[model samples]
Target: MTIQENRERPERSGGEQSAAEPSPPDAGGSPAIAVEGLRKQFGSGPEAVTAVEDVSFSVERGSVVGLLGPNGAGKTTTIKSILGMVLSDEGSVRIHGIDVYDEPRRAYAHVDAMLEGARNDYWRLTVRENLRYFSTIGGVDPDSIADRHERLLDKLDLADAADQPVRSLSRGMKQKVSLASVLASEADVVFLDEPTLGLDVESSLTLRRELRRIVAERNLTVVVSSHDMDVIEDICDRVVIMNEGRVIADDSVENLLHGFDARGYRVTSADLDETVVADLRDRFEVTEIERSGDRTRVEVATDSDGFYALTAFLRSRDVTLDAVETVDWDLEDVFVELTRREER
Candidate 1:
């Protein structure tokens, strides 16, 4: 099915019976989502293209996980397989201990997703009307959740525009509305893709802060996929990184950033001439160099031993160190390092 059809699925039609209360995942503790050895391929024989291979991960209840990878790294395929949008070639996916393929309705009764930014929203419907409509389709009574919708609008800063047609709103506002619609439903598990795709700095920050608040308030389980490293680092408790259709790193943001041993440094010196700069480049991995008037700054990635040797060489050349700063590694740095290592 197309993405639009998938987004609108589990829909109730006229004359259909009211949906039963969503069954709990399992009696004992079960993960909100679990995928094991998932693999997917397209085409046949020599033309076959494997989009995902042996990707595995689990997300606990009431937590947020980020699914990350460059293009063609299987992030999309893996997500689709878990959501039952694509049938995988191997492995298993369970939501709350209920097999997705075996008991799709029970497994996904309390799940909702917002894919491709603002596309999930209805352009002609007012913001409030869209929320009520989605809630109804999700087997929820819109009137019963009216207070919840009000709170969502206030928290997302859409209260003023609650009655405005969605198409009349700005792009960033529409994105916020799409997210609100997903939360408007009674779904406990949510998937958000590129939640902040086209927002200004302030708008992005607002959405990020409100999303975290709403997730915590509801104890919701979230799986987010985005190209924004800062968004992942700020919002996710853990990250699952994919490279070449395989799982390369799965750990908390803190562990991944700290576990990486490579450290970078920036040094500024007024005495760094062309000779010194060339010599420094030859001896170390100098990633960047900048010269402003009489001051020159150099950035290098190295270990403790290499760092000491660099200082010694600079001293020998009579280069006075005007300033030195350690460059702390962020999520982007760790991601690049891991993906590059896999490629090598």
Candidate 2:
């Protein structure tokens, strides 16, 4: 579809809206990363294990895309293939229009990765020493290296620990240092594999914020492989969920949440009878019913119009609902619903 056409479409439930409109190509400005019909299989003959199958997607420039899946779902394999660490049996991966297999050096020129425990600095070196070492290796100009070191140290809140050895740093600090190394390289595309794996709540939040900022300010394309639903929902503009080496869902987080179309209402009343419960169940997915003393609490799922119908049904039966509270859907619910559907 054309860019203008894509921009005018109204949002809709399910994949109908998004799948119908594939993103337009960048034309002269190629996408930061693109994978087409990517397939990977380990070993040969009957003993082979297919790790990735027919995966196709593109990361828009400056966009933060989340790569999500359950354990052993080929996320790592796909990432490794993109980085040219592993060769795909079929399909192609391009970084800034340079085919990874055809020209590994050129394709990797725009790419930088920080897989879990990625060693970008020496443990025995001081933080300042590590920065200087990476800067020189990355070929930063002498004047610019000094400027970048000061900026990175201050921005990542590592100035206080600048003189400490890398081994003495906390997990969060190390993560920050790793991220700083990537930023220091001035690469256009970055892959962060479980960036917040061992971080505490506050550290995770900080890392996520920094990632978003870097992507926005630098116009950097980033692929974050993470299991944290909250992190994906908060930072990602879109997500690609894979299962058993195949992509099951590829859409914006908003679209995923809306696709489920499951909304709930909590109703409190003096008492409820079996007949009333049966009547409500006929029209809605009754998730829960709790009773305590004189009050009865019922949780029912219904769409906007269905909710109105439910209220009318209750009124007709002379059941006075003391309070009705609406509950909005969230990413966790959407994730569970989609993953469950895929399983079946």
For model 1, the local distance difference test gives: 0.84
- Looking at model 1, the pairs that clash are none
TM of each candidate vs. truth? 0.89, 0.79
lDDT of 2 by residue, 1-344 (tens): 00011322311101111212222234478888889999999999999999999999999899989998888789989988887667789999977787767866555644667776455456677887766655454344435657766777787788899899878998888777776666665566788888777777887787777777778888888899887889989999999988889888889988887775547788999857878888888877999999888888899887777888888888888998889998777766776666778899
Best by lDDT: 1
- Candidate 2 clashes: the total is 0
Where in model 1 is the C-alpha error above 4 Å? 1-18, 273-275, 289-296
Q: Which of the numbered candidates is closest to the native, going by highest TM-score?
A: 1
